[model samples]
Target chain A: MNLSRTKIGAILAAPTVVYMVIFFVVPSLILFSYSFWSSESYRVVPDFVFTNYLDSLHSAVFWKVTINAVRIGLTTAAISLVLAVPVGYYLVYVSRSQTMLYLILITWFSSYLVRIYAWRTLLGTNGVLNAVLLQLGIVDHPVDAFLFSSFAVTITLVHIYLPFCILLVTSSLSEIKPDLIDAARDLGTSSLGAFFRVIAPNAANGLAGAFMLTFILVAGDYVTPQMLGGSSGQTTGLLIADQFRKTGNWPLGAAQAFVMFVISIALYFILVSLGRATGLIVKRRTINPKGI
Target chain B: MRKIWSTEDILQLHLSRRVFLGGATALAGGVALGPFLPGSAHAAGGDLQIMAWEGWELSDELADWRTKNGVNVEVSAIGNQDDVTSKFSSGNPPPFDAAEYNQGYSDLYIDVLKITKPLDKAKIPNYSKENLFDVFYDKPTWYRDGKLHGVPYAWGLNALVYAPDKVEKPASYTDLLKPEFKGKIAIVDDTLATWPLAATLAGFGSKFPHLTKDEMASTFENLVKYRDQARVISLTYGDAVSLMVSGEVVAVLIGWTGIPVETAKQGLKTEYTIPKEGATTWCDAWFMPPSVDNEETSYKFINEAISPEIQAKVVTRNAAGVVSSKAVELLPPETKALFDYSDVNGIFKAAPLLGIPPLKSAEHATYADWVAAWNEFKAG
Candidate 1:
């Protein structure tokens, strides 16, 4: 008639565990297995082979797009997090009303493609920005660099993912009590000093998680880059998708995907370590039950 | 110490567990059997299901036919031929009675995948040489191994489109490489349509649909030169139109005739021409899959697809060419001006509908190779 805490926890987690095992875990394992297989005439053959991986590694196009993806991902994540922090701080500590947060969330109701096209309209050669610049006589000719470049892709990605980053940042910042900031301020610390020494270190893990999540989404997005990145906008995600959709080479696509996955994992660890090295992430030590 | 439960409590617990287990089993069973259900199959009973291009549905055109036959039709629109191929090759394909494939994909669907069934000419009376243009008759892409595999419906050309106000009409694909047109041109990212045009530019036009690996590499190398002139690579025909309409690019390499019409709507006048180096053409056809449940209804649908009334509407709506000779008379002035119906054979000779690269070949580059090369070119 009574259950232990562990037993109750297991019972509560059973449905999610079963669902994930069936959907995510099983499919991921299958996809991993497929990376070692081979394809001929658009048909996948079950066999252990390193050709797909080796070929991708040796491919110039693969390396080119992978680097492009990383650049776009990192730049977009950094900008989104930077912009999100201020808004998140204002909402969590300074603001009383939830209207600002709701307005930020409302932007997501518009379609993703619509937002990308909206950026295109604002950044095009004859777009509003160019028209304003032309009217002001900023330059004689319209600038063609605004749209269909890595700049356009990054700007659009920042707009799309900023609200998501803000939500994460707000949630992280809320956990650090206002008393900590007031305490730091009372101890001769400025507002900026409190943010760096008291706030950032405490929310380091959540902030890193927010950054990495945004990075992964941006890197793996094929549609936005295809729409706005122009000739140089092609990324590993688009290349991998092309393998599956156009070439019908599942093994090659799977191999490229795993390579990107490994890169993302490595980047996450590197980011966390960098935070620690910069002293932005303070390490917590576990205490012994008895004196050592 | 164990707590004792009342008889009612035990019964309630047992009943709740049974109900949970029963619900879980039912959910799992439904998930497993969902695809094979009547409506899920898409072509249940006498209903006809087709996978086709976005505007190829001809819903309004075929409304009377549906009412007369008392048959319901369903169509799934696709963005590209790969959408259909991927579905059929996914191991558990949708139960589509009919599907459309471009000329380049006929060999793929019919020969490699073996997913198509030959048509009975007797069932489709509208799809005859007398009704349709003779230029579409007896092609190896549609008729293979002495059997009719596809019924040709709509056709179009992928050629050079330029703004008449900004630049003179290009006489050759190489004209795009001129210094004056630099940074004012774009190539649509459609490999199937662009590859043959690349071959034309590379001086291997005659050897297209059968390019050697060296020739394929040369073709892409030539395309990369055009990339230098291109300010951006448009992802779709709409993107290309947007570029021209916004004055971002004065010209587009390997653009569709429909681009000018689309741009015209936006108050931009553009023109498309088959240059001296020639253009690549596309012809879409309808074929019944081997899994067709209602062959008679499928045949009727395909028949109506190529009929004069339906063809005229679809061609005008899509800004594409019609297969039926009778449809030409029904076409509006703007739509009729898109192609030279009086010289249909000449147009075919100039920009013939070419097959895609072979799937597997010992002496030539395969479709996979072309895709890889195309990606490399795009990445630049």
Candidate 2:
């Protein structure tokens, strides 16, 4: 009744493979095919033409929105990673109790819509923060800049996805051996230097993973931006949604979405490459430093 | 059409309409409450699934119907009219028996998808053409090939709503830019809601929903003033209501008629007004999907929905005007005041209503352009 390595591997991978084929690959192929079609009035014509893509390319707003999408995605990922690394480090290296870690993780349990609306309540001009500020004499008037701006959307997104980032980074940091850090420090390396030489290189994969995940999530989001981004929150996702919903132009929406998908993949590789280069620097510093 | 009629005319006209609703109500009530008829082709009991906006069910009425008829009536709140198209276009055999969407979406529902059957005239004997306002009942806009495919169930105006204590009575959309109202205004974050009203205020009342790009650009240029004053571009009806309830905004542009009703429940006194330039209006309709099962039940429910009792509940509780002309007679004085309906002509004069723009047609700027312009406007 013993299974071979290959057979076991196949058995383990079979479910995921089936799931992706049915859920991801099939829908993606359909979406890709739709990108090549055109819409006459509200009805989608399945004719293969480059009109949708051509139209998207010709429009300046598409490019502007696409660029804004990437900018916001990258910004959100960078901020989330920056904030997450410290928390991840503390949880893995300093914190002894699982209670604190679980408390932080529990934040994710709240509904996404509730979390977004909570931010809406907090940052609104007449919201709690403004009232408190006014009462405390911090400001004479309620600040209008706190909500319905890109600032509000970014801050909300960072809070929403921070738990996931911390989880990923902590998972990677936990895999590092305590002996490796002790060894580096024992070799005349400073705590900071050892961290750069040993810890950061080991944690690069998790950091990159968090970055990519946060980027994709933030970039494709329409609700957060639509709700909070009063005037400045027009992302490619919103435009794409408008196509399907407001315009009834499914083909154009599909085309816009695929274009973004391609951009996101390209940005992900660039992040990966940047991670590799950083890892190489750390490796060279620890193993083949010019001064050492 | 511009001439105003006397109150007597409305009372006289409403009498016949009330009689029709009374007869239909009795017939529907008998069928619903009585034991199942032996020769009926469609069975009486089954799930009646509906996709609609919030407050469509009128809980008391639904609970009463369910108790009497032994049928489960389930309603799922849809976000917008586009969700209706998504449900239909995903594939044939729509998920629900019926859907509630804007009357103007008939082009997409009836002409484009053909998922709707031409409504059976005999099935909904309560529906009277004279009961509905002319702006919404015009079939060339809502129907194709002269076949009626939907029944207007709910109607409301998109206008400026203001907090009376916080701001002066806003007589026009231009007051959104008053220095005193600065940073205390919210506008709807929608192209259809924003642009039509903006165009009208920019002195393009007759040309609204058909504005040229130059005209739209100029209108948006004017909109920038209001945008500067606005605290938020509310994304939905709830968003607008929240802005008022939270005291984030003293006034809202493109506010739905229901906003004041919701704010009042929150203990905030607010007023909705169609400005001097005019206001835009929308209608929610119920149409059976192509794959509708329990067809008999759907028809019966549609008929019952327009009955005097249900229509009264819809107007008072839900803050919507009933399509049935007779529903006005059944409404309490306070409920009637909410709609500003002293008479039928007053109801008709609520606004120089704007219809849904032809997004799919080439006669106007494409939907993409309108949205893009909004983004650009917001960006600035």
Candidate 3:
């Protein structure tokens, strides 16, 4: 019952490779092919044409919404990471409590829709926050600006995604040995200096992963933006969904999706480059967590 | 001699492996793609499949029907109106025997997709006998090319729903912009219902469903004020209900009758009022998709849907307006009070009907144009 090295490798990779090819690669290729097609009379016509892309490029709304989506994504990711790092660092380094971390992460077990609606209740004009603010005399009147805006969308997304970011950063931080920090301390470096030089670079992989995951999730999310974002917060995700769900304009939707995909990839590389330049990540070195 | 592999031999091995993988992938793809390949309609036989909007299925009646007839009815609750027409048009064997679509989408369902089939009068005697609302029977919207493509099911209006305690009953759509309602109002996020209602109140009712660019701009100009005064633009009946129940939104401009009915059930003092300028009424109807596999069952389901018993149940459970006049008789006194049936002769007069116009009707703007204008309004 011996297997060759190639056979063993194939067996180990088969499930993932097959799954990706079936679900991701195949659907993506179909979507790519559709991007070049056209729709007439609410039917997807299988003509290899450039009209959809041309129309998307020409439409001012398309670009505005696309840029809006990216802006939200970047803002959400940065804020989530900034807010999560300290919490994650505290849990791992100071508290050393995985139980508390798990408890925080467990809040996500509730439905996403429920969470979004909960935010709506808390942020609406006559909502809990407004009531509290008014009663405390912090505001003379209930604030209409609290909900149904881009700010509400961003705030809710940050709150929803913060736990995930914390979990990712905590996983990364836990791998750092205390002796490494002690060694850095023994070398006459301050705690902040040791954190920057020894800790941050090693946690770069997890940070990058967390940022990308949050950014992509926030950008592609249609429900939160539609529910909380209201009129002001409409994003390209809603447009794409409308094409499929309401308009039956698959080709144009596919093209818009591809455009967003291209923009996301470009932004990802830019972030990676920035990370590298800032000395947060070093080139040609595996981020071995145990030591340098 | 020990065998040594040449580049050609290695290439051949790699090619063989790749070919095997490719074949497996192709087989998997073919199996997946088989269900979606389009085909012609066939007569529906035994198992009944229905696709309808949420709360339109009349589940208790369906269970009773299932018990008596020994037929299984599978219902898919659609989220959007476009879903009804486009779903059967796309799927092979066409997923549902019948679908419930808004009459507003008749152009897409009957004219564009041509997916709806002529109802067999023999199977549905109740519809043929005009037992339903007079407005629905043989109407051009439901009846086209001498074929009865649809039968009216349930109808409702997107009107003003307000908490009577917090706000006085809104008399007009223009009440949305009142100084009192500033920062206390909400509106639904439906362009079709909201636009016409707005246009009517703005003294442009005659120009509705076909407003000129200037007309649309003016209508939206009025709407911008409403939008500014609003707390949130609700996406669904449930969203509005949640807002009303939580005391977040004291009033909603485009709130559905169903929302107040729901909120009232939750013990909120919510009341729906048709504004001075008539609210837009939308109706859902049962129509057979082209690929019906259970024609007998579909017709039976439609017949049962409009029957007094089922209609009363649906009205009570879903708070929907039934098409059948007989159903109004069967309704409990409390339920009957919810709907105004006094204007038996004037269903359209009570609430202005909005649907796709006939192909010959000259219109300055299409639904797409209206959507664009709405999007501009929303974007602002």
Candidate 4:
């Protein structure tokens, strides 16, 4: 007898189930456990100690850095999402040329290190940006601010996540029925009105998805802050790294990571609730004259 | 289900000679490939790889001794002795077979019982009475219960470096810490190094690492004053040198070993000083580790390194440090003028090797605090 469909489904899903268990679920649980313990020399004690948690919460610096991390994450998500929406729509709908869209996406395929390094060269003290400004007589001296500002970090993050946002929004836009556009046009709606009312609502889910992913990536990154933030760029992530590496204090690092994880989870849930509320209001629209 | 064979099944199929031959061949190949992989028995050697100050690499004469003795030796050359210590503390087993202790510092807790095994002088003939001077040789800190544990390697004074054109005639070590030269100066970020210079300038070096609360307060005041003018507290000797060379920063406190040579070669008209207040000098010595398997070869390497030919080579490669009794004769006259052995005026040396407190164990927090304090200082 042939294997049942349910059995086949289980067989196909076995790889994913194993994947999550081995890489995601297990490591996170282990890391969670480590956060509760103390390390005296290099030796780790398994006892639960809340001192690390207390230290992170009590310090004004921790709070300051956490707020900065949130600001960075949200700013990155907003910029990447806003910039991606237009590009993705244009690629999927406005442009009929397959070669152009493919050419556009090919840009994202380069290594991230190469992109960051290029940006570094451009913004460096004696870099292209400064050189150009000097030539134009825009400023008297080389601009160290371009490389070592919070602005560089936000710009770089937006650049890194823009492709992801486009990929997400493009896929969502692809899911919209072509007939819906035709139906809206048949009802005498303008192309812009149809897009804002119909296509955007369908793609709201993708926008939320992109925001969620980008926020996590931006919040956890330490290198961008270190390289671009200068002395002022001391982020919570860099502090967490310091605790583990130089301080040889694993418990403290783990605790800080745990707090960050908790904050990220809370933000995710808050965004989800807000999205649900907005999505409900959008789905209630009765503007369509002849609903099927 | 497909059938799987266990050990019992394999034994039961012992009649298959072709399969047995294939298994035997595979096992032999694995054995042959073993030595080529990391952590293999043959890859495990008795030779200990040492990362050390530039003075420790090789003597010009000992290239013959090393080749003839059929012993493998690998040396990683570095500028500052503290850098070698930093690597050892950074996990992944200690870096080398043996490191030279900062002269007279063989007794420090970091080196003594923890990293190095004490030496028996009877085994190594080159460790004679005359080579190590009275200041280092007579130090009981280098000896445990009156036995020499390490062979004195190379020692030098770290001094004030300034561009002659800019500074004119700066007097004492105190001149570098002044506000007028602030942003125009570079300093080695030793965390505690400025303590000797700062303390001495603040009238407290004689009470180093042991100070009355009042003295500590004065030192802190001086440090806060010094901190005001500095642009950046660069963390490495290389960084200090770079900032100085690029003219982004002109004068720096630097290790005498490699940098003064660079200063001379650049024709920068820079001066390295020993102030009237007195200076600190330090020496590094070769130490034996308990892990050393062939003491005979190790002893030979040590003895050959200190002999006149190699000592002279060490001096040549390292501009300031004197590795052996005869190393002074090898130096060019101008380089000799830059640093002197007898002068303690402007040069600040390494702390005495032994009997000092091990630098605070959980000192990373101290660094973090410094960064925070520095940021506040800069903001102000």
Top candidate when judged by lDDT against the true structure: 1
- Residue-wise C-alpha lDDT for candidate 2, range B196-227, written one tens digit per residue: 77777677767877777788788888888888
Pairs in steric clash, model 3: B44-B293, B44-B294, B45-B293, B45-B294
lDDT tens readout by residue for model 3, B272-369: 88877766788888888777777777887888888878888887787768788878888888778766777744767755567742222244655555
CAPRI tier for the interface of model 4: incorrect
The lDDT ranking, best first, is: 1, 3, 2, 4
With a 3 Å backbone cut-off (N, CA, C), the pairs that clash in candidate 1 are none
User: What would the per-residue lDDT of candidate 1 be over residues A1-292, giving only the tens digit for each residue?
Assistant: 8999889999999999999999999999999999999998778999999999999999999999999999999999999999999998999999945999999999999999899889999999989999999999997888989998888999999999999999999999988999999999999999999999999988988899999999999999878987888876999998898888787899999999999999999999999899899988777566675654
| True contact recovery of candidate 4 | 0.00
* lDDT value for model 2: 0.78
The 10-residue segment with the lowest total lDDT in model 4 chain A: A280-289
Best by TM-score: 1
1 against 3, candidate with superior DockQ = 1
After superposition, which runs of candidate 4 have C-alpha atoms over 4 Å from their true positions?
Answer: A1-47, A61-128, A141-230, A245-247, A266-292, B1-113, B117-189, B192-228, B242-247, B251-320, B342-380
Give candidate 4's error at residue B63 in angstroms. 7.3
Question: For candidate 3, what TM-score does chain B get against the true chain B?
Answer: 0.82
Per-residue lDDT tens digits for candidate 4, residues A1-292, read 7998889999999999999999999988887888888866434578888988998898776777777778888888889888988887788777856776677678689887667656767776667888899999999997656764678878887887777777887787887877898899999999988887788777776677788788888888866754455444556786676565444566777888999989999998788788777762143345554674
Docking quality (DockQ) for each candidate: 0.53, 0.40, 0.27, 0.09
